[model samples]
Target: MGKGKNKTHEPKNERQQRGANGHSARQNHKHMEMKYDKSEKMKFPVKLAMWDFDHCDPKRCSGKKLERLGLIKSLRVGQKFQGVVVSPNGQGVVCPNDLEIVEQHGASVVECSWARLEEVPFNKIGGKYERLLPYLVAANQVNYGRPWRLNCVEALAACFAIVGKMDWASELLSHFSWGLGFLDLNKELLEIYQRCTDADSVKKAEKEWLEKLEMETQERKSHTKKTDIWMMGNINRRGNGVQSDELESGEDSEQSGLENSEQPIEYDALGNAIHVDSVKSRIMLSGVSEDEESDFEENEKPVNYDSLGNLI
Candidate 1:
Protein backbone atom coordinates (compact mmCIF):
# COMPACT_ATOMS: atom_id res chain seq x y z
CA MET A 1 0.00 0.00 0.00
CA GLY A 2 2.82 2.42 0.90
CA LYS A 3 4.70 1.74 -2.37
CA GLY A 4 1.51 2.25 -4.41
CA LYS A 5 0.88 5.69 -2.82
CA ASN A 6 4.51 6.82 -3.47
CA LYS A 7 4.34 5.80 -7.15
CA THR A 8 1.02 7.65 -7.68
CA HIS A 9 2.39 10.85 -6.03
CA GLU A 10 5.59 10.77 -8.19
CA PRO A 11 3.53 10.54 -11.40
CA LYS A 12 1.31 13.50 -10.39
CA ASN A 13 4.37 15.67 -9.65
CA GLU A 14 5.90 14.79 -13.05
CA ARG A 15 2.63 15.66 -14.74
CA GLN A 16 2.48 19.04 -12.98
CA GLN A 17 6.12 19.78 -13.95
CA ARG A 18 5.37 18.93 -17.62
CA GLY A 19 2.36 21.28 -17.56
CA ALA A 20 4.51 24.16 -16.27
CA ASN A 21 7.12 23.54 -18.95
CA GLY A 22 4.49 23.60 -21.69
CA HIS A 23 3.10 26.92 -20.43
CA SER A 24 6.55 28.52 -20.36
CA ALA A 25 7.22 27.25 -23.89
CA ARG A 26 4.01 28.79 -25.15
CA GLN A 27 4.81 32.14 -23.53
CA ASN A 28 8.27 32.17 -25.10
CA HIS A 29 6.82 31.46 -28.53
CA LYS A 30 4.29 34.32 -28.15
CA HIS A 31 7.03 36.74 -27.07
CA MET A 32 9.14 35.80 -30.09
CA GLU A 33 6.15 36.32 -32.37
CA MET A 34 5.56 39.77 -30.95
CA LYS A 35 9.25 40.66 -31.37
CA TYR A 36 9.23 39.39 -34.97
CA ASP A 37 6.12 41.36 -35.79
CA LYS A 38 7.65 44.53 -34.45
CA SER A 39 10.77 44.01 -36.52
CA GLU A 40 8.72 43.36 -39.65
CA LYS A 41 6.69 46.51 -39.10
CA MET A 42 9.83 48.55 -38.69
CA LYS A 43 11.63 47.10 -41.71
CA PHE A 44 11.64 49.68 -44.52
CA PRO A 45 13.93 52.36 -45.90
CA VAL A 46 11.49 55.23 -46.32
CA LYS A 47 8.13 55.27 -44.60
CA LEU A 48 5.69 54.04 -47.24
CA ALA A 49 2.01 54.41 -46.39
CA MET A 50 -1.40 53.85 -47.94
CA TRP A 51 -4.92 55.14 -47.33
CA ASP A 52 -6.89 51.97 -47.97
CA PHE A 53 -10.56 52.60 -48.67
CA ASP A 54 -11.42 48.87 -48.58
CA HIS A 55 -12.99 49.20 -51.98
CA CYS A 56 -10.83 46.48 -53.53
CA ASP A 57 -10.41 42.78 -53.20
CA PRO A 58 -8.39 41.86 -50.15
CA LYS A 59 -6.60 39.17 -52.13
CA ARG A 60 -5.77 41.34 -55.13
CA CYS A 61 -5.29 44.67 -53.45
CA SER A 62 -1.62 45.58 -53.78
CA GLY A 63 -1.84 48.06 -50.95
CA LYS A 64 -3.18 45.47 -48.56
CA LYS A 65 -0.57 43.02 -49.68
CA LEU A 66 2.13 45.57 -48.94
CA GLU A 67 0.60 46.13 -45.56
CA ARG A 68 0.61 42.42 -44.91
CA LEU A 69 4.21 42.23 -46.00
CA GLY A 70 5.07 45.07 -43.62
CA LEU A 71 6.33 47.24 -46.46
CA ILE A 72 3.65 49.87 -46.01
CA LYS A 73 1.45 51.11 -43.22
CA SER A 74 -2.28 51.84 -43.57
CA LEU A 75 -3.91 55.12 -42.61
CA ARG A 76 -7.46 56.10 -41.71
CA VAL A 77 -9.60 58.21 -44.01
CA GLY A 78 -9.04 61.55 -42.23
CA GLN A 79 -5.47 60.92 -41.16
CA LYS A 80 -3.12 63.76 -41.92
CA PHE A 81 0.26 62.88 -43.41
CA GLN A 82 3.07 65.38 -43.83
CA GLY A 83 4.60 63.74 -46.87
CA VAL A 84 4.29 63.46 -50.61
CA VAL A 85 0.75 62.41 -51.36
CA VAL A 86 0.18 61.11 -54.89
CA SER A 87 -3.26 62.28 -55.90
CA PRO A 88 -4.94 62.40 -59.27
CA ASN A 89 -6.06 65.95 -58.62
CA GLY A 90 -2.66 67.08 -57.41
CA GLN A 91 -1.52 70.44 -58.65
CA GLY A 92 2.14 69.66 -59.24
CA VAL A 93 3.99 66.76 -60.75
CA VAL A 94 6.39 64.64 -58.72
CA CYS A 95 10.05 65.06 -59.59
CA PRO A 96 13.52 64.25 -58.31
CA ASN A 97 13.57 67.63 -56.64
CA ASP A 98 11.09 66.26 -54.12
CA LEU A 99 13.59 63.74 -52.87
CA GLU A 100 14.45 65.74 -49.78
CA ILE A 101 10.84 66.18 -48.82
CA VAL A 102 10.04 62.55 -49.35
CA GLU A 103 12.99 61.30 -47.34
CA GLN A 104 12.14 63.55 -44.44
CA HIS A 105 8.37 63.06 -44.45
CA GLY A 106 7.79 59.82 -46.44
CA ALA A 107 5.45 59.04 -49.35
CA SER A 108 1.89 57.73 -49.49
CA VAL A 109 -0.78 56.82 -52.08
CA VAL A 110 -4.53 56.41 -51.85
CA GLU A 111 -5.72 52.87 -52.37
CA CYS A 112 -9.12 52.84 -54.04
CA SER A 113 -10.89 51.85 -57.21
CA TRP A 114 -10.26 54.22 -60.08
CA ALA A 115 -13.88 53.89 -61.07
CA ARG A 116 -14.83 55.13 -57.59
CA LEU A 117 -12.50 58.06 -57.25
CA GLU A 118 -15.39 60.42 -56.53
CA GLU A 119 -16.41 58.39 -53.52
CA VAL A 120 -12.97 58.68 -51.97
CA PRO A 121 -12.61 61.37 -49.32
CA PHE A 122 -9.86 63.38 -50.92
CA ASN A 123 -10.40 66.57 -48.95
CA LYS A 124 -10.31 64.79 -45.62
CA ILE A 125 -7.05 62.97 -46.36
CA GLY A 126 -4.83 65.95 -45.70
CA GLY A 127 -1.19 66.13 -46.66
CA LYS A 128 1.38 68.91 -46.67
CA TYR A 129 2.78 68.00 -50.08
CA GLU A 130 0.17 66.77 -52.55
CA ARG A 131 1.50 65.89 -56.00
CA LEU A 132 0.64 63.96 -59.14
CA LEU A 133 2.54 61.32 -60.99
CA PRO A 134 3.48 62.14 -64.51
CA TYR A 135 2.57 59.92 -67.42
CA LEU A 136 3.31 56.30 -66.51
CA VAL A 137 2.07 52.93 -67.76
CA ALA A 138 0.67 50.48 -65.22
CA ALA A 139 2.28 47.07 -64.91
CA ASN A 140 -0.05 45.52 -62.37
CA GLN A 141 -2.46 42.76 -63.37
CA VAL A 142 -5.54 44.93 -63.00
CA ASN A 143 -4.45 47.86 -65.14
CA TYR A 144 -1.53 46.47 -67.07
CA GLY A 145 -0.38 48.59 -70.03
CA ARG A 146 -2.83 51.34 -69.10
CA PRO A 147 -1.72 54.91 -68.59
CA TRP A 148 -2.25 56.65 -65.24
CA ARG A 149 -4.14 53.67 -63.81
CA LEU A 150 -1.59 52.43 -61.34
CA ASN A 151 -2.71 50.51 -58.28
CA CYS A 152 -1.43 51.28 -54.82
CA VAL A 153 1.88 49.47 -55.20
CA GLU A 154 2.60 50.75 -58.66
CA ALA A 155 1.69 54.30 -57.64
CA LEU A 156 3.94 54.07 -54.60
CA ALA A 157 6.71 52.67 -56.74
CA ALA A 158 6.36 55.53 -59.19
CA CYS A 159 6.60 58.01 -56.35
CA PHE A 160 9.84 56.41 -55.20
CA ALA A 161 11.25 56.21 -58.69
CA ILE A 162 10.50 59.84 -59.43
CA VAL A 163 12.04 61.00 -56.15
CA GLY A 164 15.37 59.25 -56.95
CA LYS A 165 14.74 56.34 -54.58
CA MET A 166 15.21 53.47 -56.96
CA ASP A 167 16.24 51.04 -54.21
CA TRP A 168 13.19 51.76 -52.16
CA ALA A 169 11.00 51.45 -55.20
CA SER A 170 12.57 48.17 -56.13
CA GLU A 171 12.13 46.93 -52.60
CA LEU A 172 8.43 47.73 -52.55
CA LEU A 173 7.95 46.11 -55.94
CA SER A 174 9.92 43.02 -55.04
CA HIS A 175 7.07 41.90 -52.79
CA PHE A 176 4.90 41.46 -55.87
CA SER A 177 5.40 38.91 -58.63
CA TRP A 178 4.67 41.43 -61.37
CA GLY A 179 6.51 44.27 -59.65
CA LEU A 180 9.56 44.38 -61.89
CA GLY A 181 7.32 44.73 -64.89
CA PHE A 182 6.22 48.16 -63.69
CA LEU A 183 9.78 49.42 -63.91
CA ASP A 184 10.20 47.88 -67.34
CA LEU A 185 6.93 49.28 -68.67
CA ASN A 186 7.76 52.79 -67.54
CA LYS A 187 11.50 52.64 -68.11
CA GLU A 188 11.71 55.31 -70.78
CA LEU A 189 9.22 57.64 -69.16
CA LEU A 190 10.72 57.12 -65.71
CA GLU A 191 14.12 57.94 -67.08
CA ILE A 192 12.82 61.16 -68.53
CA TYR A 193 11.13 61.96 -65.20
CA GLN A 194 14.22 61.27 -63.12
CA ARG A 195 16.31 63.55 -65.28
CA CYS A 196 13.97 66.40 -64.46
CA THR A 197 15.32 68.71 -61.77
CA ASP A 198 11.91 70.11 -60.86
CA ALA A 199 8.20 69.56 -61.24
CA ASP A 200 7.96 71.93 -64.22
CA SER A 201 10.72 70.02 -66.01
CA VAL A 202 8.85 66.78 -65.45
CA LYS A 203 5.71 68.30 -66.91
CA LYS A 204 7.66 69.50 -69.91
CA ALA A 205 9.14 66.05 -70.47
CA GLU A 206 5.67 64.48 -70.32
CA LYS A 207 4.34 66.96 -72.86
CA GLU A 208 7.18 66.24 -75.29
CA TRP A 209 6.68 62.50 -74.96
CA LEU A 210 2.96 62.82 -75.58
CA GLU A 211 3.56 64.92 -78.68
CA LYS A 212 6.05 62.41 -80.01
CA LEU A 213 3.63 59.55 -79.41
CA GLU A 214 0.89 61.42 -81.23
CA MET A 215 3.16 62.08 -84.21
CA GLU A 216 4.12 58.43 -84.39
CA THR A 217 0.48 57.32 -84.21
CA GLN A 218 -0.48 59.73 -86.98
CA GLU A 219 2.35 58.53 -89.18
CA ARG A 220 1.29 54.93 -88.69
CA LYS A 221 -2.29 55.73 -89.68
CA SER A 222 -1.13 57.61 -92.77
CA HIS A 223 1.01 54.68 -93.84
CA THR A 224 -1.95 52.35 -93.43
CA LYS A 225 -4.08 54.58 -95.67
CA LYS A 226 -1.46 54.59 -98.40
CA THR A 227 -1.22 50.82 -98.20
CA ASP A 228 -4.99 50.48 -98.58
CA ILE A 229 -4.99 52.71 -101.68
CA TRP A 230 -2.20 50.67 -103.26
CA MET A 231 -4.02 47.42 -102.56
CA MET A 232 -7.22 48.80 -104.07
CA GLY A 233 -5.38 49.80 -107.24
CA ASN A 234 -3.89 46.32 -107.51
CA ILE A 235 -7.32 44.70 -107.08
CA ASN A 236 -8.81 46.92 -109.80
CA ARG A 237 -6.04 46.00 -112.20
CA ARG A 238 -6.53 42.29 -111.46
CA GLY A 239 -10.23 42.60 -112.26
CA ASN A 240 -9.37 44.13 -115.65
CA GLY A 241 -6.98 41.26 -116.55
CA VAL A 242 -4.13 43.78 -116.70
CA GLN A 243 -0.74 43.32 -115.07
CA SER A 244 -0.06 46.00 -112.46
CA ASP A 245 3.00 47.48 -114.20
CA GLU A 246 1.34 47.45 -117.64
CA LEU A 247 -1.84 48.89 -116.14
CA GLU A 248 0.16 51.76 -114.62
CA SER A 249 1.72 52.67 -117.99
CA GLY A 250 -1.60 52.34 -119.82
CA GLU A 251 -3.39 54.53 -117.30
CA ASP A 252 -0.64 57.17 -117.55
CA SER A 253 -0.87 57.26 -121.36
CA GLU A 254 -4.67 57.43 -121.31
CA GLN A 255 -4.60 60.21 -118.77
CA SER A 256 -2.08 62.21 -120.79
CA GLY A 257 -4.15 61.78 -124.01
CA LEU A 258 -7.36 62.85 -122.27
CA GLU A 259 -5.57 65.94 -120.90
CA ASN A 260 -4.17 66.91 -124.35
CA SER A 261 -7.41 66.35 -126.34
CA GLU A 262 -10.36 68.76 -126.56
CA GLN A 263 -12.71 68.20 -123.67
CA PRO A 264 -16.44 67.81 -124.39
CA ILE A 265 -18.88 70.26 -122.85
CA GLU A 266 -21.61 67.61 -122.98
CA TYR A 267 -21.34 63.89 -123.79
CA ASP A 268 -23.31 60.60 -123.78
CA ALA A 269 -22.32 57.37 -122.13
CA LEU A 270 -20.83 56.09 -125.43
CA GLY A 271 -18.63 59.26 -125.68
CA ASN A 272 -20.89 60.83 -128.37
CA ALA A 273 -20.98 64.61 -128.36
CA ILE A 274 -22.38 67.52 -130.47
CA HIS A 275 -19.84 70.24 -131.29
CA VAL A 276 -21.08 73.80 -131.70
CA ASP A 277 -19.59 74.60 -135.10
CA SER A 278 -22.10 77.38 -135.92
CA VAL A 279 -22.35 80.92 -134.59
CA LYS A 280 -26.01 80.43 -133.60
CA SER A 281 -27.78 77.51 -131.90
CA ARG A 282 -30.29 75.43 -133.87
CA ILE A 283 -33.24 73.45 -132.49
CA MET A 284 -33.02 69.94 -133.90
CA LEU A 285 -35.13 66.77 -133.58
CA SER A 286 -33.86 63.85 -131.57
CA GLY A 287 -33.38 61.58 -134.63
CA VAL A 288 -33.18 62.04 -138.48
CA SER A 289 -32.87 65.87 -138.34
CA GLU A 290 -30.23 68.47 -139.24
CA ASP A 291 -28.08 66.87 -136.46
CA GLU A 292 -28.04 63.60 -138.44
CA GLU A 293 -26.85 65.45 -141.57
CA SER A 294 -24.09 67.12 -139.56
CA ASP A 295 -23.07 63.79 -138.02
CA PHE A 296 -22.87 62.09 -141.47
CA GLU A 297 -20.99 65.01 -143.00
CA GLU A 298 -18.40 65.08 -140.13
CA ASN A 299 -17.93 61.32 -139.69
CA GLU A 300 -18.44 59.84 -143.22
CA LYS A 301 -19.03 60.73 -146.91
CA PRO A 302 -22.65 60.95 -148.08
CA VAL A 303 -24.00 57.59 -149.34
CA ASN A 304 -25.63 57.91 -152.88
CA TYR A 305 -28.27 55.12 -152.63
CA ASP A 306 -31.53 57.09 -152.93
CA SER A 307 -32.01 56.64 -156.76
CA LEU A 308 -30.85 52.97 -157.15
CA GLY A 309 -31.51 51.81 -153.59
CA ASN A 310 -28.14 50.01 -153.71
CA LEU A 311 -24.69 50.31 -152.22
CA ILE A 312 -22.34 53.05 -153.56
Candidate 2:
Protein backbone atom coordinates (compact mmCIF):
# COMPACT_ATOMS: atom_id res chain seq x y z
CA MET A 1 0.00 0.00 0.00
CA GLY A 2 2.91 2.40 0.80
CA LYS A 3 4.53 1.77 -2.58
CA GLY A 4 1.20 2.26 -4.38
CA LYS A 5 0.66 5.55 -2.58
CA ASN A 6 4.16 6.72 -3.53
CA LYS A 7 3.55 5.76 -7.21
CA THR A 8 0.20 7.57 -7.21
CA HIS A 9 1.84 10.74 -5.80
CA GLU A 10 4.51 10.71 -8.61
CA PRO A 11 2.12 11.49 -11.53
CA LYS A 12 0.46 14.26 -9.58
CA ASN A 13 3.82 15.90 -9.05
CA GLU A 14 4.70 15.21 -12.69
CA ARG A 15 1.45 16.75 -13.87
CA GLN A 16 2.11 19.78 -11.64
CA GLN A 17 5.57 20.18 -13.14
CA ARG A 18 4.13 19.91 -16.66
CA GLY A 19 1.50 22.50 -15.81
CA ALA A 20 4.16 24.80 -14.42
CA ASN A 21 6.21 24.44 -17.60
CA GLY A 22 3.18 25.28 -19.75
CA HIS A 23 2.46 28.30 -17.64
CA SER A 24 6.03 29.44 -18.11
CA ALA A 25 5.68 29.08 -21.84
CA ARG A 26 2.49 31.10 -21.83
CA GLN A 27 4.24 33.79 -19.81
CA ASN A 28 7.06 33.82 -22.31
CA HIS A 29 4.57 34.30 -25.12
CA LYS A 30 3.20 37.31 -23.30
CA HIS A 31 6.73 38.65 -22.90
CA MET A 32 7.20 38.15 -26.58
CA GLU A 33 4.20 40.37 -27.11
CA MET A 34 5.86 42.96 -24.90
CA LYS A 35 9.18 42.49 -26.70
CA TYR A 36 7.58 43.34 -30.04
CA ASP A 37 5.70 46.29 -28.60
CA LYS A 38 5.46 49.51 -30.66
CA SER A 39 5.31 53.18 -29.58
CA GLU A 40 1.90 53.55 -31.11
CA LYS A 41 1.79 49.91 -30.04
CA MET A 42 -0.86 48.63 -32.35
CA LYS A 43 -0.61 45.20 -30.57
CA PHE A 44 -0.38 42.09 -32.73
CA PRO A 45 -3.60 43.16 -34.41
CA VAL A 46 -4.68 39.67 -35.40
CA LYS A 47 -6.30 37.13 -33.12
CA LEU A 48 -5.92 34.12 -35.41
CA ALA A 49 -8.77 31.82 -36.54
CA MET A 50 -8.45 28.84 -38.86
CA TRP A 51 -10.95 28.76 -41.73
CA ASP A 52 -10.37 25.01 -42.30
CA PHE A 53 -10.47 25.19 -46.11
CA ASP A 54 -10.09 21.43 -46.56
CA HIS A 55 -10.18 18.67 -43.98
CA CYS A 56 -6.55 18.58 -42.86
CA ASP A 57 -4.79 15.51 -41.45
CA PRO A 58 -4.81 15.72 -37.67
CA LYS A 59 -1.24 14.42 -37.30
CA ARG A 60 0.68 16.40 -39.92
CA CYS A 61 -0.77 19.82 -40.63
CA SER A 62 0.18 23.49 -40.09
CA GLY A 63 -3.21 24.22 -38.53
CA LYS A 64 -2.52 21.58 -35.91
CA LYS A 65 0.88 23.09 -35.22
CA LEU A 66 -0.71 26.51 -34.81
CA GLU A 67 -3.26 25.04 -32.40
CA ARG A 68 -0.44 23.55 -30.35
CA LEU A 69 1.20 26.94 -30.11
CA GLY A 70 -2.14 28.52 -29.07
CA LEU A 71 -1.93 30.87 -32.06
CA ILE A 72 -5.44 30.01 -33.20
CA LYS A 73 -8.27 31.33 -31.01
CA SER A 74 -11.34 33.55 -30.97
CA LEU A 75 -12.31 36.35 -28.53
CA ARG A 76 -15.81 34.99 -27.94
CA VAL A 77 -17.46 31.58 -28.28
CA GLY A 78 -18.86 32.20 -31.79
CA GLN A 79 -17.76 35.64 -32.92
CA LYS A 80 -15.07 35.95 -35.62
CA PHE A 81 -11.53 36.37 -34.28
CA GLN A 82 -9.99 39.74 -33.43
CA GLY A 83 -8.26 40.44 -36.76
CA VAL A 84 -9.68 41.09 -40.19
CA VAL A 85 -10.62 38.07 -42.35
CA VAL A 86 -8.07 37.65 -45.14
CA SER A 87 -9.38 37.32 -48.66
CA PRO A 88 -7.96 36.83 -52.16
CA ASN A 89 -10.48 39.23 -53.64
CA GLY A 90 -8.73 42.29 -55.07
CA GLN A 91 -11.21 44.56 -53.31
CA GLY A 92 -10.11 43.72 -49.74
CA VAL A 93 -8.19 46.25 -47.66
CA VAL A 94 -4.46 46.30 -48.47
CA CYS A 95 -2.17 45.00 -45.71
CA PRO A 96 -1.43 47.87 -43.39
CA ASN A 97 2.07 49.01 -44.33
CA ASP A 98 1.32 52.30 -42.64
CA LEU A 99 0.33 52.66 -38.98
CA GLU A 100 -2.97 54.40 -39.71
CA ILE A 101 -4.45 51.50 -41.66
CA VAL A 102 -3.25 49.04 -39.07
CA GLU A 103 -5.18 50.87 -36.38
CA GLN A 104 -8.31 50.75 -38.51
CA HIS A 105 -8.10 47.06 -39.37
CA GLY A 106 -5.26 44.90 -38.19
CA ALA A 107 -4.38 42.45 -40.96
CA SER A 108 -5.75 38.94 -41.55
CA VAL A 109 -4.49 35.99 -43.63
CA VAL A 110 -7.01 33.62 -45.20
CA GLU A 111 -6.20 30.06 -44.16
CA CYS A 112 -6.30 27.75 -47.18
CA SER A 113 -4.72 24.42 -48.06
CA TRP A 114 -2.32 24.88 -50.96
CA ALA A 115 -2.67 21.27 -52.13
CA ARG A 116 -6.43 21.70 -52.47
CA LEU A 117 -6.69 25.48 -52.97
CA GLU A 118 -9.43 25.22 -55.59
CA GLU A 119 -11.54 23.18 -53.18
CA VAL A 120 -11.71 25.88 -50.51
CA PRO A 121 -14.93 27.87 -50.15
CA PHE A 122 -13.42 31.38 -50.11
CA ASN A 123 -16.75 33.13 -50.56
CA LYS A 124 -18.57 31.29 -47.79
CA ILE A 125 -16.01 31.63 -44.93
CA GLY A 126 -14.93 35.24 -45.62
CA GLY A 127 -15.73 38.06 -43.10
CA LYS A 128 -16.49 41.78 -42.98
CA TYR A 129 -12.97 43.12 -42.40
CA GLU A 130 -11.62 41.53 -45.57
CA ARG A 131 -7.94 42.33 -46.03
CA LEU A 132 -5.42 41.37 -48.70
CA LEU A 133 -1.73 40.97 -48.05
CA PRO A 134 0.48 42.76 -50.56
CA TYR A 135 2.73 40.87 -52.98
CA LEU A 136 5.08 38.61 -50.99
CA VAL A 137 7.39 35.82 -52.12
CA ALA A 138 6.90 32.47 -50.41
CA ALA A 139 10.00 30.55 -49.30
CA ASN A 140 8.30 27.40 -47.99
CA GLN A 141 9.28 23.94 -49.28
CA VAL A 142 6.08 23.78 -51.31
CA ASN A 143 5.97 27.30 -52.70
CA TYR A 144 9.33 29.02 -52.87
CA GLY A 145 9.46 31.97 -55.30
CA ARG A 146 5.68 31.72 -55.53
CA PRO A 147 3.74 34.86 -54.72
CA TRP A 148 0.77 34.69 -52.27
CA ARG A 149 1.35 31.00 -51.57
CA LEU A 150 2.08 31.39 -47.87
CA ASN A 151 0.85 28.85 -45.36
CA CYS A 152 -1.11 29.88 -42.25
CA VAL A 153 1.90 30.90 -40.16
CA GLU A 154 3.77 32.56 -42.99
CA ALA A 155 0.73 34.69 -43.73
CA LEU A 156 0.56 35.85 -40.09
CA ALA A 157 4.29 36.55 -40.07
CA ALA A 158 3.90 38.71 -43.15
CA CYS A 159 1.15 40.76 -41.50
CA PHE A 160 3.34 41.25 -38.43
CA ALA A 161 6.29 42.37 -40.54
CA ILE A 162 4.13 44.70 -42.63
CA VAL A 163 2.76 46.35 -39.50
CA GLY A 164 6.36 46.93 -38.26
CA LYS A 165 6.50 44.06 -35.73
CA MET A 166 9.25 42.19 -37.55
CA ASP A 167 10.64 40.76 -34.35
CA TRP A 168 7.24 39.30 -33.56
CA ALA A 169 7.20 37.67 -36.99
CA SER A 170 10.66 36.24 -36.48
CA GLU A 171 9.79 34.87 -33.02
CA LEU A 172 6.60 33.22 -34.24
CA LEU A 173 8.42 31.69 -37.18
CA SER A 174 11.16 30.40 -34.84
CA HIS A 175 8.68 27.64 -33.91
CA PHE A 176 9.57 25.81 -37.15
CA SER A 177 12.94 25.08 -38.79
CA TRP A 178 12.04 26.59 -42.18
CA GLY A 179 10.54 29.72 -40.65
CA LEU A 180 13.80 31.65 -40.71
CA GLY A 181 14.46 30.40 -44.21
CA PHE A 182 11.25 32.06 -45.39
CA LEU A 183 12.52 35.36 -44.01
CA ASP A 184 15.92 34.93 -45.69
CA LEU A 185 14.41 34.24 -49.10
CA ASN A 186 12.14 37.29 -48.85
CA LYS A 187 14.37 39.54 -46.73
CA GLU A 188 15.26 42.04 -49.46
CA LEU A 189 11.76 42.46 -50.85
CA LEU A 190 10.02 42.35 -47.46
CA GLU A 191 12.20 45.16 -46.20
CA ILE A 192 11.19 47.25 -49.18
CA TYR A 193 7.50 46.39 -48.90
CA GLN A 194 7.36 47.18 -45.18
CA ARG A 195 8.42 50.73 -45.90
CA CYS A 196 5.59 51.29 -48.35
CA THR A 197 2.48 53.00 -46.93
CA ASP A 198 -0.11 52.11 -49.59
CA ALA A 199 -1.00 49.54 -52.25
CA ASP A 200 0.35 51.65 -55.13
CA SER A 201 3.64 52.07 -53.30
CA VAL A 202 3.72 48.34 -52.60
CA LYS A 203 3.20 47.65 -56.32
CA LYS A 204 6.08 49.97 -57.25
CA ALA A 205 8.26 48.18 -54.68
CA GLU A 206 7.28 44.81 -56.18
CA LYS A 207 8.40 46.01 -59.61
CA GLU A 208 11.67 47.30 -58.23
CA TRP A 209 12.27 44.00 -56.43
CA LEU A 210 11.53 41.96 -59.58
CA GLU A 211 13.86 44.15 -61.63
CA LYS A 212 16.65 43.70 -59.10
CA LEU A 213 16.02 39.97 -58.98
CA GLU A 214 16.18 39.71 -62.79
CA MET A 215 19.40 41.71 -62.83
CA GLU A 216 20.92 39.39 -60.22
CA THR A 217 19.75 36.36 -62.20
CA GLN A 218 21.38 37.73 -65.34
CA GLU A 219 24.62 38.39 -63.47
CA ARG A 220 24.59 34.77 -62.24
CA LYS A 221 24.04 33.38 -65.76
CA SER A 222 27.61 33.80 -67.12
CA HIS A 223 27.64 37.62 -67.24
CA THR A 224 25.27 37.94 -70.18
CA LYS A 225 23.99 41.43 -71.12
CA LYS A 226 20.47 42.26 -70.09
CA THR A 227 17.57 42.75 -72.59
CA ASP A 228 17.10 46.27 -71.27
CA ILE A 229 20.68 47.14 -72.22
CA TRP A 230 20.07 45.98 -75.78
CA MET A 231 16.86 47.99 -75.85
CA MET A 232 18.77 51.10 -74.70
CA GLY A 233 21.36 50.65 -77.42
CA ASN A 234 18.65 50.46 -80.08
CA ILE A 235 16.99 53.56 -78.65
CA ASN A 236 20.28 55.48 -78.76
CA ARG A 237 20.84 54.53 -82.42
CA ARG A 238 17.33 55.66 -83.36
CA GLY A 239 17.93 59.21 -81.98
CA ASN A 240 14.40 59.40 -80.58
CA GLY A 241 11.64 56.85 -80.73
CA VAL A 242 8.44 58.53 -81.86
CA GLN A 243 5.57 57.77 -79.50
CA SER A 244 2.56 56.04 -81.07
CA ASP A 245 0.29 59.05 -80.53
CA GLU A 246 2.89 61.49 -81.89
CA LEU A 247 3.50 59.28 -84.91
CA GLU A 248 -0.23 59.14 -85.60
CA SER A 249 -0.54 62.93 -85.25
CA GLY A 250 2.43 63.51 -87.59
CA GLU A 251 0.94 61.12 -90.17
CA ASP A 252 -2.40 62.97 -90.03
CA SER A 253 -0.64 66.31 -90.47
CA GLU A 254 1.33 65.00 -93.47
CA GLN A 255 -1.86 63.54 -94.99
CA SER A 256 -3.71 66.87 -94.61
CA GLY A 257 -0.70 68.75 -96.04
CA LEU A 258 -0.69 66.41 -99.06
CA GLU A 259 -4.42 67.00 -99.61
CA ASN A 260 -3.95 70.80 -99.32
CA SER A 261 -1.03 70.74 -101.80
CA GLU A 262 -3.42 69.33 -104.42
CA GLN A 263 -5.07 72.78 -104.70
CA PRO A 264 -3.27 74.61 -107.50
CA ILE A 265 -1.68 77.90 -106.45
CA GLU A 266 -1.66 80.93 -108.77
CA TYR A 267 1.54 82.90 -108.08
CA ASP A 268 1.73 86.72 -108.55
CA ALA A 269 3.95 88.15 -111.30
CA LEU A 270 6.09 89.63 -108.48
CA GLY A 271 6.83 86.00 -107.38
CA ASN A 272 4.87 86.15 -104.18
CA ALA A 273 2.59 83.35 -103.01
CA ILE A 274 -0.97 84.57 -103.56
CA HIS A 275 -3.48 83.81 -100.87
CA VAL A 276 -6.58 82.06 -102.30
CA ASP A 277 -8.77 83.55 -99.56
CA SER A 278 -7.33 87.03 -100.30
CA VAL A 279 -8.20 86.63 -104.00
CA LYS A 280 -11.76 85.75 -103.09
CA SER A 281 -11.94 88.61 -100.59
CA ARG A 282 -10.68 91.10 -103.22
CA ILE A 283 -13.12 89.69 -105.74
CA MET A 284 -15.93 90.22 -103.24
CA LEU A 285 -14.62 93.69 -102.32
CA SER A 286 -14.33 94.70 -105.99
CA GLY A 287 -17.84 93.40 -106.67
CA VAL A 288 -16.72 90.77 -109.28
CA SER A 289 -19.58 88.25 -109.48
CA GLU A 290 -18.78 84.50 -109.31
CA ASP A 291 -20.45 84.25 -112.79
CA GLU A 292 -17.92 86.70 -114.34
CA GLU A 293 -15.00 84.71 -112.85
CA SER A 294 -16.16 81.43 -114.48
CA ASP A 295 -15.02 82.40 -118.04
CA PHE A 296 -11.24 81.67 -117.75
CA GLU A 297 -10.41 78.06 -116.83
CA GLU A 298 -7.41 77.07 -119.03
CA ASN A 299 -4.84 79.89 -118.52
CA GLU A 300 -5.41 81.12 -114.95
CA LYS A 301 -3.34 84.28 -114.18
CA PRO A 302 -2.65 85.67 -110.74
CA VAL A 303 -4.75 88.71 -109.84
CA ASN A 304 -2.63 91.79 -109.08
CA TYR A 305 -3.26 93.48 -105.73
CA ASP A 306 -2.67 97.24 -105.24
CA SER A 307 -1.07 98.78 -102.13
CA LEU A 308 -4.61 99.91 -101.28
CA GLY A 309 -5.43 96.25 -100.49
CA ASN A 310 -7.65 95.81 -103.56
CA LEU A 311 -7.19 93.72 -106.75
CA ILE A 312 -5.78 95.98 -109.54
- What's model 1's lDDT at 138? 91
Per-model TM-score, in order, reads 0.64, 0.49
* Candidate 1 segments exceeding 4 Å error: 1-42, 229-233, 236-312
lDDT of 2 by residue, 216-241 (tens): 99676523322222212122212234
lDDT of 1 by residue, 1-312 (tens): 111111122355543233211333345335434543653556776667666665677788887677656566555456778889988757898899999989988888887778878877688884978888989999988888889888888888899999878888888898899999899888888988999999999999999999999999998876564443342222331122434454344453322232254642222122222222321121121123566557766898543321112333
| Best-matching candidate per lDDT | 1
Clashing pairs in 2: none
Candidate 1, residue 221: lDDT: 77
Steric clash pairs (candidate 1): none
- Looking at candidate 1, the ten consecutive residues that score lowest on lDDT are 278-287
